[model samples]
Target: MPQATALYTAKTKRCEARKKKRRMTEPTQTESPDTTPLILDVDGTLLRTDMLYESLWAAAGRNIAATLKTCVTQWRAPNLLKHALCEIAAPNVALLPLRPAVLDLADAARQAGRAVHLASGSDQALVEAVAQRLDLPGPHFGSDATRNLTEQSKAQMLVERFGEGGFDYVGNSNADLPVWSKARRIIAVSPGGTLRHRLEAMGKPLEVVEDRSDPFALLREMRPHQWIKNLLLFLPLLVAHEFGLSVFLAALMAAAAFSIGASAIYILNDLLDLESDRLHPEKRNRPIASGALQIRNAMIASAGLVVLALTSAWLVGPPVAALTLLYMLTSLTYSFWLKKRRWIDLASLAFMFLLRVLTGAVAAQIAVPGVVMAFVFVVFFTLACVKRMTALARDVDHGKLPGRGYGADDFRALKVLAAAGIVLSAAAFLLYAFSGHSGGLYGSQMIFAATVLPLTLWLFRVVRLSELGREDYDPIQFVTHDRIGLMIMVIGVALVILSL
Candidate 1:
């Protein structure tokens, strides 16, 4: 009996020694005055953008077909989708838009002898890369093939690691609600109105980090100023001398429809070009590239705009609707495929502008002379080339233009081609004026012919400005904003009106 007791005592002592060893190795609640670690939510908290979406954009940019295939294959496995996207994307950590305030807070916490951890729903590899790039001190926890570490899962992990109410959480979205409830302190970074309301309801002490987002961020994303380009839809109505109320209304509706569709395409382009835009000098300020707008919200807005555009197109007429559909399909093709093809991209832009005129003609039920259409095509093509040349000048030092499949050597060729296009445009305009079409439409052929002089001067000025590297990348934008271009436009319009 004594031997058995001795054995039991020996087993008890062994267990006690093991417990003591664990106590020595594990961190204690009182290890330091700042025992609670700062747990950062990577997406929208530590970083201004979501890494998962950023990775998806990069993957799509690399090979859209492969990215789509991977997404389909892993539709039911989000963690695997994230991993696959990360592998394909291989994002540059230094280029990501990080929130300075959140980063400063994390650094301060670390300096205060508190642990700092990055907890995110992003793939493990992506999280590790960002943490390492920022030189973060603590370990990172991220989603893997089996689990997506977010919301409740993130809260559960923190509770398991540090115990409930033992850590501080920094997050931005409503999804962080559960984690915030579990955290001892809530640090809100750019919390929206709904999140602010919820935090107030919780009656918990909170630290607010201002987002510094532009107040007109959504409008900027929609690019309302770019809608001015859709005025091309009115050219046919004006040139055909159809000023009746019905024709005017149809043209207006067509313009609105095109604007809506163009805005949708712009949003999609921004999403696809996020990585490339981040590398660009000026384009990096775009709302999506700068992380001022969320990807999911942008996607929703784009879808909504497309629906509105289609509905408005249908209201105009069947032919107008068909033309609008064609424009959308062509634009989609350009965004997805042709935009990456050097010369083809310029041709596609010119074609889209011509389609706007065609749409206007259909909406107004007016005939546009074939020669006039040819002039429009050539002029728009020259302008498109000029835009490309300006972009090439800016990006030549990089050897290759971002998002565009053009090399530095192509600049001289593009300039030569643009000059040829300008000559062709002038010839087309002269042919239209002398071919008797203008005499049939206008009271005086000489007056109509005189309009070409201002047009030539305007085109020359545009080309010279572009060559001097003093033009906007968008030629239409430059024409709309430049004082000399606007003056020339007004004079040309006045001459055309006199001829009519």
Candidate 2:
């Protein structure tokens, strides 16, 4: 008990010393008589994200049960919760997204010989770390063990330090209203809703820094374009020449179910890969990575999508519902574990694609020929290899892929394997076209063989583009947008229809 008391006393003294040093060095309104001090809010103002949520996400990623237990224990003690979370999952200061405009504004204010202070509702330790990382001017204030500095508390503290209307304030949310009322000048960053209306009532802000991101950011996060891959579910119906109303409707429902389930997986993957995504050049702009969408909202959306998918699949058929559940489980496993293992990730992706075709067959109540199943697996497996090759090719630095076993050096071997996969897929198609089932399904099996040519050409084109380091890492997405690929696909489909 005495040792614990001594440790507590030492920590208290250190905190007091730091506060005293800040007070002596940082200029208040009285010390800076010639220039008005500029006070800035941190979360959603100076930075694109809230530190509290970021820390909590990291904590949850580490151990969800332990984090939840800590939350329950410290439910009534905000400061203790903050400390516990910080200790569990401190953010990488260098990777935290910063608002360039806000930083520029602070820099300009400092250049004009004005004192700039960072005041936030976040823990003082976090606030201080952020300020130090950015090399911001003057003292930074934040909630400590004894106080949760925000709203009225923030306003009161600022009023006492700088006096009413003695400073300029920059912030983004409704929580800043009290501080704004106390400031001489108000600068708003990405202000909207009630905050915008209140700022308008007070007249135009000194400056309004607009956030330049797509309004359809949430839709983009869902990646509707990628839903085209789910159309593979219709392939079984097409192959079986079963275009009946019931089969068509069932196929469509299955596609919808798969799309929703895939979206949930995508959201989960994004959340798990937040740190790596931020480090990635292209992925950093993703909604969750860029802080355009809240993690909490994303989690809720993922859960809702999972439930909707299962329900939709159940409406389609019992077999389809089982397949959908299997797909979800496989995808979740791949995302959390298998994706990091060499060869296993590619195999899992191929299996997933095959599952779509199998589910489609079950949905349409059709028994796909063994040769047709072989063809589907080989084709999708090849396409999966192409996807990975493209990703590795574009990653030019030869650096290891985050959370994956592949690297740039593996590109050559992958290309050879992908080529082999393409050849095997063509062989499977040929076998199917020559089989007895082909005679039953088509008037001229010879015409069905024509599909192999276009398929071969499209696969080669995909490989070439990937080797050239093209932007379309997803071969499915590439085919959807590529005019020549689309034309080839149309001709191929037409040939199959002619044979039918």
The top-ranked prediction according to lDDT is 1
Candidate 2: the clashing residue pairs are none
- Which residues of candidate 1, in runs, are more than 4 Å off? 1-32, 192-204, 396-398
- The 10 consecutive residues of candidate 2 with the worst lDDT sum are 27-36
Cα error of candidate 2 at position 480, Å:
2.4
CA lDDT of 199 in candidate 2? 82
lDDT of 2 by residue, 214-327 (tens): 567667788888898888899888777789998899999999999999999898888777787887778888998887876777788899999999999999988899999999
Which lDDT tens digits does candidate 1 get at residues 1-500? 99999999999999999999999999888543776899999988888788878888788878888999999998788888899987787667788898999989988998898888999999988888888988886679999977999889999999999899999999988999999998899999878888899987887789999877776767899899888888988888766677899998999999999999999989989988887889888889999889888887788999999889999999998788888888988988888889999889989999999999999888988889998888888888888878877887766474888788887788788888888887888788878777765667888778888888898888888877787788987665777789989999999989888887
Steric clashes per prediction: 0, 0
